[model samples]
Target: MAAEAKQSSYDGSHVENFEFYLQCSGEHESILHFLMKHLPEEFERIGADKSGLAVLGVGSGGGEVDVQMLSLMQSTLSALPITADIVEGSTELVAKFKGLVTKTDHLQKIPFTWHTMLSEEYMQKTKGRGDVKTFDFIHMIQMLYYVDDLTETIKFYHSLLNKNGRLMIIIESANSGWDTLWRTFSKELCNEILPVYRSSSDVLASLKSLGLKYEEHFIPNTFDITECFDPNSKTGQHLISFMTGRENFYQSFTPRVRADILNVLRSKCSTEKEGKVSFNSEMRCVFVYA
Candidate 1:
């Protein structure tokens, strides 16, 4: 059973904490690989030259994408200057990312640094100091929602970018079939649903208003509900991840709503003959000039 959702300011630490969703996911790594390819295209558009680029990973949870991007950056810029700073918003994830770099074998490929701060606070501080033009690339991966103002964040990074620097953002695509189903059935399912800061459509419109253009791409993810009931093949990972998240936001719900949510989740996750169980996550790669 879970408690109600907590009614607190979005913690800076939730970035990496949220990565649990992907970590427990079976098809997450492949989507990550796809994001790398999409990212460079934007980097090139901003005239990065793919060499010696100083990159910032804003809200870089768990340093997963930062590590992958830095590796790709190293390969692309062997002769040029290549340094990366992964800025995390979560305390635990910041620690996890640092630990990962020191502990991971392949981390030696790229030179990198780590910092942790809320995107909004960091932007405010960076602005106050005029230390804005420090990065050639900044990635706000699934993080802008935590901040109260999207325009301020957009403007902040827009200023921080060096000449031809690029800003890339990644967020869940809310217009997918899974999202549709989640919204429709979630009320009946009694399963816990986490809140998203921006809907897919809203984010798209916001980016568009900034005069920044983006290419839409998706990394398909699935919660293989069928695997859940099979104790032999039981991936307790999904259940645990879902359950844990429910635990955090659980307190926000009333007992009656909570039970209804979980009940529907179990049935929806049941292995029926025509069990359609794939949630498509759309990742939009937004690119702007330096």
Candidate 2:
């Protein structure tokens, strides 16, 4: 008989950090201002009279952040009556998001579709549809780390939007105190135990060098994850995928050395300085018009 693969090995409880991270990184306003780039005073503009607008959310993982954002966006666009669609790579997440929307009375009124698709596939379809400049607000939140081609990605969003439509790409700033501290605090741990994702700013610069005209914002959000590391939480299971490249990622140390590093890092990370445990993050919000 074939060896059974381990089930329930991945924990994603840290996803709860999405809300806290959004606050620490200041992503809350980025989405709203993203809409305003084209429609001056976007918060005040989304009314019934305006042509129903469409917003596309790319890489809307687990739809947790989207849930928080949607609440804020919903009330903001209560005036525009915009239709929003989310592009997610995970089917389970899509179902979860739909459930969240259905359960929430306020969200039920928002006309939204969840496209269970990857960014590349969605972009291909968007291009094949020949709908150049079709979106009013396109957003890529905390998803750029997976892409190798950031410029092409941004251009694709730009192509899919109408002249006045805007695309918002949110990335964490490498220079923020929160990020700086995390890197410093977790350097030994990260270098040995986890695979690091590329920074979003690198991609932003790549787009700018290509001569793309875009506006940007700095928003901060914080997260408290002491319990996420608890042995009892499913959140720890979420590390399986993130650990895919562990062997190479931990290449800097011997196996035993790496293990030691992980233990130390976890202890330090879980340490609380005061009544609450917290870390800050900076999100860079970029807006480019169609």
The candidate maximizing lDDT is 1
lDDT of 1 at 78: 51
Q: Candidate 1, which ten residues in sequence have the lowest lDDT sum?
A: 1-10
Mind giving the per-residue lDDT tens digits that candidate 1 earns over 143-253?
654456777677777767777787776655665433443464444323322343354565668767877745555655555454433334435433433433433334455
Global lDDT of each model?
A: 0.56, 0.55
After superposing candidate 2, which stretches have Cα over 4 Å from the reference?
A: 1-49, 131-133, 176-196, 222-280
Instruction: Please report the candidate that would top TM-score against the real structure.
Output: 1
Whole-model alpha-carbon lDDT for candidate 1: 0.56
Give model 2's TM-score versus the native structure.
0.64
Candidate 2, 161-229: lDDT as tens digits? 765666777776665432443355354434321234344467567777777777777665545544333
Kindly give the stretch of ten consecutive residues in candidate 2 with the minimal lDDT sum: 1-10
